[model samples]
Target: MNKPDVSYSIFQDWRANRGNIKAQFILSLFRLATWVRSNKILIILFIWYLPFYRFFVEWVMGIELPWSLKAGRGLKLQHGQALVVHGQTIIGSNCGLKHSTTIGIRMNPDGSVGRAPIIGNNVDIGAHVCIIGAIEIGDNVAIGAGSIVVKSIPPNCVVVGNPARVVKVNEPVTSSYS
Candidate 1:
């Protein structure tokens, strides 16, 4: 992404997290860490800071948004509790994640880790949702609460149930984020 787009994304993140102190602090720290890691000279400092970041964000706050995760701008965290995301996961811009959501990689039978999900833009993930394995969640998708998704979903739809079947297609975004 261009510098302007990055800046816009940062601003959008700020807007998304407004009035949420925990989210603001965590996102700000994540941004700082990401910036530090981008610079070769600052990487050493980031190595030192990683422990504290993990302790505070994971242990204290109960959220596990790693700095290494490639998430786009306007990421919203509602409830901001028990939200875990895999490091290799790629989340698109304007995505909203609720509490107790897990976006993680699956374990192979050979005792190896698999790929994380690639969440597309403008996706709204409800609480207690577990999106596992090497799935691709397309743009403008809404996942219902307590859904367990293990497959790829097409764009512009609403999914529900344990296996996360598409309940509605061409669903319009109800939030002001888009």
Candidate 2:
């Protein structure tokens, strides 16, 4: 199934944190715009989402997304469509959530639900990554394309493949950084 688009509170949460730099926010906004512009197909689908995102929040889901959702300074969503963020998910600053990423919890044995994910800052989640359960992803971790992340990942690691093995380390993105 396609991931749903992000709602207005995503940006609102980022903006509310005054400690987050303005330059980083501008850069993130720029990144989002440029990435969407380059991908016309994604833009078309997301265009429709903007209205719903701007108009509806209460009528959509029951979970109340806490302020910031633990999302830090610069949150960049590249073609984020059909993405589901459960209330338990905790993200960090300068994170990248690509298209179709679902950040939620797993089903219990009795068909209830487990704990939410605790993601660190400066992380990059690739498209179609399903991160479930009570995993604590470290800072600057990059989840690879089409990965299913169930376990906790250490900081600065690049995770890939089914169940996602650490393929590389996240060397800080120094250049062109705000």
Q: Give the winner by TM-score.
A: 1
Worst 10 residues of 2 by lDDT: 1-10
Q: What's the alpha carbon RMSD for model 2?
A: 12.2
lDDT of 1 by residue, 1-178 (tens): 4446556666788899899877777887776666666667777755888778889889999999997898988899899999999989999988999999999999999999999999999999999999999999999999999999999999999999999999999955576875
- Candidate 1 has which clashing residue pairs, if any? none
| Candidate 2 per-residue C-alpha lDDT over 40-113 given as tens digits, one digit per residue, 9 for 90 to 100 | 68679667643443234323422123322444445665654456677557777667777677888889899988
Q: State each model's C-alpha RMSD to the native.
A: 3.3, 12.2
Report the lDDT of model 1 for residue 1: 41
The count of residue-pair clashes in candidate 2 stands at: 7
Q: State the local distance difference test value for candidate 2.
A: 0.64
User: Which regions of candidate 2 deviate over 4 angstroms?
Assistant: 1-68, 170-178
